[model samples]
Structure formats: C-alpha cells, structure tokens
Target: MQAVIIAALVIGIPLAIYCVCTVKREEIFEEGSGKNAEVLDDDGKITKETTMGRIIKMDKGMGEFLMANGLHCVTCTSSANESLADACIVHGLDADIMLSKIQKYLDENA
Candidate 1:
C-alpha cells in the first residue's frame, strides 16, 4: 500500500544508511583494529589491551609511575600532548627502556 511504502521508506532509509556505513568502515580496515588492536611500545612490549570495548588507559597523576619509567610527564604541561617516546626524550631517558617497562605494567595489569 502507499502508506506502507511511505512508512518503510522513512524508517528503512536510516537503518540502511547505518548498515552501509558500518560495513564500509569495516571493509576499509583490517579486522581486530580499532577497539581490538593491542597497543605496544617501541620495545615491542604490550602496553595496553582493549577490554569490553575499551583500551586500557594510562594515568599521568602518579609521579612514581611517570618518573620510575623516566617519562618526565609529571613536569611538563605538554606531557599530556606527548606520546610515550616523546615524553621519554623530553625527560632525558631511554625511550625504549622506559616504554618497555610501561608496556609490561600495562599488560600485566590490564
């Protein structure tokens, strides 16, 4: 019926668009990326793992965590903007060594 067709068009279009977008997004990237990818440091150590649709997050509040690993993130206002490797360099530490430990902690606790 004309009414049925109108109703279907209104509801079905959005659903169809959503499905298309989802499929296209998936097809563009390999599976196990995005929420499923395991992040690693320069040393090839596992830094964080995704869980229940979330990647394990790091905290910058812990001075010990930052300094012990030689990140120097605790001092720099730009630290939040820096990546692990950059943070290590700014702090005058070996990024590979520091990141290896950070990755190890993240993996063990994650």
Candidate 2:
C-alpha cells in the first residue's frame, strides 16, 4: 500500500542510519580502547608495547605527567616510536611508578 511504503521510508531510513552509525562508533571505541592490544604486559606494566606518543594522544593529563617528570621527549619526533618505559629509563625515572601514576589518573577519570 502507499501508506505502508511511506511509513517504511520515513521510519526505516532513519533506523538504518542509526544502526550503521552505532556500529561504526563501536568499532572506533574498540580500536581506541585497545581491548586486545598489547598496551600492557602480562605483569601489568606499561612496557615497550605502546609508544609514549600514543599514550599522550590518549590523554592530555598523561602528557602533562610526562613533561612534569622531565620527559621532554613527548614533543620530539622520535617520541612517536619511543616507548613509555624507554622514556622513563632515559630520564632516570622509575617506569613502574610512572605507569602506576598514569593508571591511577585514567582510573580516576574513567
């Protein structure tokens, strides 16, 4: 019927769009959250698995902590390939403590 087709067009189109958008958003969230990624080690340490630049991009507060702890490398081009633990070691910092601080911050905000 004409009424049925009109109703389907009015409702089905938006429903389909919403479903597609929701799926896309979920995919983006999964990638950003690093669900199955190697962001952390088996011992729960932030190791060379993830780069400092990626961490900084995840949270600006984390970036501030890096700078406050004398890690100016976050702004350097090499930072893209520099792991958090490597940066901590190069700056004479304890990577475990730094990772703890960052985890705490994320937990608190989350």
Candidate 3:
C-alpha cells in the first residue's frame, strides 16, 4: 500500500507540474506568434458574438485593452472558444458596456 501511494505521488506530481508548464508555454507561444500582430484586415470587427481569441488575434493592442478591462483571460486557451459576451458574463462585467467600449476603441484607433 505504501509503495502504491509513493508511486502515485511520484507519477502524479510530475504529471501535474508538466501539464501546468505546458499550458503556460502554449500561452507564451500563442502570444508571441504572428497571429497576434497589429495589422488589422477586413475581419477585425468587434461584436458581442466575436470570440475573445479572434479579437486578440485581430490586434494585440486590443488584447491590452481587454486585459485593462479585467478580461485577462484573453490569453488563455479557452478564449479561443469564448465569445466577448460569454467572457464578460464569466468575468462579472456588463457585456453591452464592454462591447460598446470595444467598439469605440476600434473606431477611434482605426
């Protein structure tokens, strides 16, 4: 029994640590990738249904804006699947207001 417990701990701890490190490394790579470039094309529109990952990929500067507004999860892998409204709800922010602000940012910056 003791040997089983020891083996589990030895395997579990390293596996857990590796999983955490892999997630962080992926976040770093995604953030540094050319996908995060500032050059916006026709697809750069911000809408409530637009995924947070799509927004960030459209322009890295927008990611900074999102982080400032407490949506720091923009860099997370989950953001790829999370829309602006979904993220705002999860973050306890008013989705409409956040969307408006994001629109204004795009308008003024564009």
Provide the TM-score for each candidate, comma-separated: 0.41, 0.55, 0.60
User: All models: lDDT?
Assistant: 0.46, 0.64, 0.70
Candidate 2's residue-wise lDDT over 4-98, tens digit each?
Answer: 99999999997886676556433433344322235656865455447875666555455556678677665454555787788888888887888
Clash total of candidate 3: 0
- Name the regions of candidate 3 deviating beyond 4 angstroms: 1-45
Give me candidate 2's TM-score against the actual structure: 0.55
Count clashing pairs, candidate 1: 0
Clashing pairs in 2: none
Stretches > 4 Å off in candidate 2: 1-48
lDDT of candidate 1 vs native? 0.46
What lDDT does model 3 reach? Answer: 0.70
Model number with the top TM-score:
3
Candidate 1 residue pairs in clash (backbone atoms < 3 Å): none
Q: Which has the higher TM-score value, candidate number 2 or candidate number 3? A: 3
Q: Flag regions of model 1 displaced more than 4 Å.
A: 1-56, 59-63
The prediction achieving the highest lDDT against the true structure is 3
Cα deviation of 68, candidate 1, in Å = 2.6
Model 3: lowest-lDDT 10 consecutive positions:
32-41
